[model samples]
Target: MTAAEAARQVAKHPIQARNPIQVLGRSALSAVRMVGGVGVFAVRGTIAALSPPWFFNQLLRQFVAIGFFSLPVVGLTAIFTGAALALNIYTGGGRFNAEQVMPQIVALGITRELGPVLAALMLAGRVSAAIAAEIGAMRATEQIDAMRTLSTDPFRYLVGPRLLAGVLMLPLLTVVADTIGVSGGWLVATRVLDFSSAVYIRNTVDFLQGWDILSGLIKAAVFGFIVALMGCYHGYNAKGGARGVGRATTHAVVSSAILIFASDYLLTTFFTHAAK
Candidate 1:
């Protein structure tokens, strides 16, 4: 109400306005630094993976953990997704009396996009979290340091195996997903939609091209690398203790999912242009 009070309030309002700008600047810098850190970590991990003195035992274990154990969930996701896609496509097609396109559309959708993306998302939740927690726990308990004391490179022994396993396993998993998803569509179309099973199978096989399947597999491999990279990056740098490990696990999953979607879009665009 007083002139002095009003002047003070006016001055404080400018400072308050500047505070948000400062916060925004800090956040942007932090994001840039985080991205740079992850990129450097990825390069180091790749080098460790490619270098000699490889650990086949660790690699084999990761293959089983990342690939074999992941089949059930991926299969379930694929089958249900395919069936749902078929239903939606058929319903939409009915509007224009084009329902017969269900088989071709379902196959194309599963092989081109849904199969690889869903499989990666599932692994991002399951495998990425597991990897981050495991490595974070090792870091928390100083076991990673212990490995260093023994002259064992933690990146070579731990990160490399997991990274290689992820890159190799995801494509295999995507293939299974594609097969199961198409089968699901076929099942739904035949049993529920009264489509002829033989015709549906024939149409799907005829309509799908090699490039469609190959592109999905390529996306799977890239997604696998992203999942493993995020997990290792967060876990390797985790601080504090139990709380840090939990935070790393959460970050790993969130980052992996975001990167998967973003990269999927990029890869899809590249493949589309290339195909043309």
Candidate 2:
């Protein structure tokens, strides 16, 4: 191409100084709408979940699947995380002769936040993507339509169980994570950090209160609901064929993970204000 033509083509795609501002506005608008939609969907689904026979069945199945089945993996993750956290904190605090804080800090930090939040994220990645892909495939292949023809409400049949399971199980998994994590911390503190088991346990118990555990459980519940909703929403709405289902599954995981962090900040802010 001639120099003039090249220059004109580049000009067509020029980076305007106002480009960032326009992009920001568009992003803000999209986010607002997205949040509104998700909230509406969640509320409606929750209403349906609380109605009659469907609710009880979903609740039981979910409780078993989410709380009982997730125990092993959650426990394993928590244990290692707690041990690592104790070691790191001890090493860092040693500089200021504050190694005494390790046990208590580790317990409070894990029980109050990390244990529940991380466990939820892990479960979201595992469960949300799976649900999304499954639902997306069903939708793509007209299986969902067949369910309607058979007089089944797809939301009640498919989304309800998974949603209930996630919301109910997360808090249970979180409790498991907290317990295992604290135990791990205890092991490290006594064996590697040269702290006495009695001192470690005492500090851990003394520093952690009812509010801390309650907060963690609440966060787990929110995380669980978000993960399930995101998965179901994406999968149920998936387009195209197998490729589309895969893409939806990926989107569900990414979106669910991002939402977890964003919600964590909001939940922390609320907890901080409440404590104040």
- Provide backbone clash counts, one per model: 0, 1
State candidate 2's TM-score.
0.86
Q: Per-residue lDDT for 20-107 in model 1, tens only?
A: 6555655566688898999899998999888888999999999999999999999999999999999999999999999999999999
For each candidate, the alpha-carbon lDDT, in order, equals: 0.93, 0.84
- The predictions' CA RMSDs to the true structure, in order, are 6.3, 6.3
TM-score of 1: 0.93
Candidate 2: tens digits of C-alpha lDDT, residues 1-276: 975564454446545424675456555655787789778778766765666448466567667766676777788889999999999999999899999988888988998888988898888878888889889999999999999999878877777777878887898889889999999999988888788888888888888889999999999999999999999888988999999999999999999999999999999999999999
